[model samples]
Target: MTRKYIDCREFPSEMNCTVAISADSEKELLEAAVQHAVTIHHHADSPELRAQLVTLFHEGTPPTEAPRTA
Candidate 1:
């Protein structure tokens, strides 16, 4: 697992963010991104965000959670 730090300082200027993870494939990247979001950004990342991150990092698929049927 080779980790990379993506410094998105050029685009989305407001976000002074850095993503560090070992993502060999597309799926890994998405998972890492979500983890980064929840743990660091504290953002309840939407599915759209997950998809975008997948495209950006070219890694893992984001895991889907089943809706709670109370």
Candidate 2:
């Protein structure tokens, strides 16, 4: 199966977090993403948040460099 990933830089945040996470499966990706969100981003853990996180997941590993901002 293809790897799954979550790129923090894709989301708008005050910190402009650049952390990126990848996993072999969706379940693992979701768990790590959730933990990172709650701990670093101060997000509340819930089914709703979990659902939202799933939407942010993408196939393959995250990019090595941050997107160029204009």
Candidate 3:
């Protein structure tokens, strides 16, 4: 199965976080991403946030090169 990833740098945040989460499935990625969001970004856990995160999900492993901010 293909891996999934969520890059914090892709999202808008006051912290400008550079964290990137990966998992074997979307469900796992969502769970981990949400926890990181709540704990590190001080975001409230909600369905809306979960849905937004769903849109940010990408297939395959995260890039080893630095994330592009522009």
Candidate 4:
């Protein structure tokens, strides 16, 4: 069995989170995401945030900061 690691940075104030999960397969990644959200964000099982976390992980796109035009 191969274990994977997911780098997650959650910001509750911003209502945005960044998660970089790397697993042997998508299945493992999803599992990890759920656990992480629950433990870190205090999201109980079947919470909406869990789904959102999974979606963010699956999307595989990091959050980007907009440039200031000043």
CA RMSD of each candidate after superposition = 12.7, 1.7, 1.4, 6.6
- Rank list by TM-score: 2, 3, 1, 4
- Output the better candidate (2/4) by TM-score: 2
Lowest summed lDDT window (length 10), candidate 2: 61-70
Query: In model 3, where is the ten-residue run with the lowest total lDDT?
Result: 61-70
Which regions of candidate 3 are displaced past 4 Å? none
- Rank the candidate models, highest lDDT first: 2, 3, 4, 1
Candidate 2, residues 10-56, lDDT tens digits: the string is: 76778989999999999999999999999998999999999999998
Residue 7 in candidate 3 has what lDDT? Answer: 88
Please give each candidate's TM-score.
0.50, 0.90, 0.88, 0.47
Candidate 4, residues 1-70, lDDT tens digits: the string is 4644444553333544555557766577778778776776677878576566555542333334421222
Q: Estimate, for each residue in 1-70, the C-alpha lDDT of model 3 and write its tens digit.
A: 9999998876567777888899998999999999998999888999999999999899998887647776
Deviating ranges (above 4 Å) for candidate 4: 1-7, 10-19, 58-70
Model 1 scores what on Cα lDDT?
0.52
Q: How high is the CA lDDT of each candidate model?
A: 0.52, 0.91, 0.89, 0.57
Which predicted model would earn the best lDDT? 2
lDDT of 1 by residue, 26-62 (tens): 5655676688777777768799878766555523322
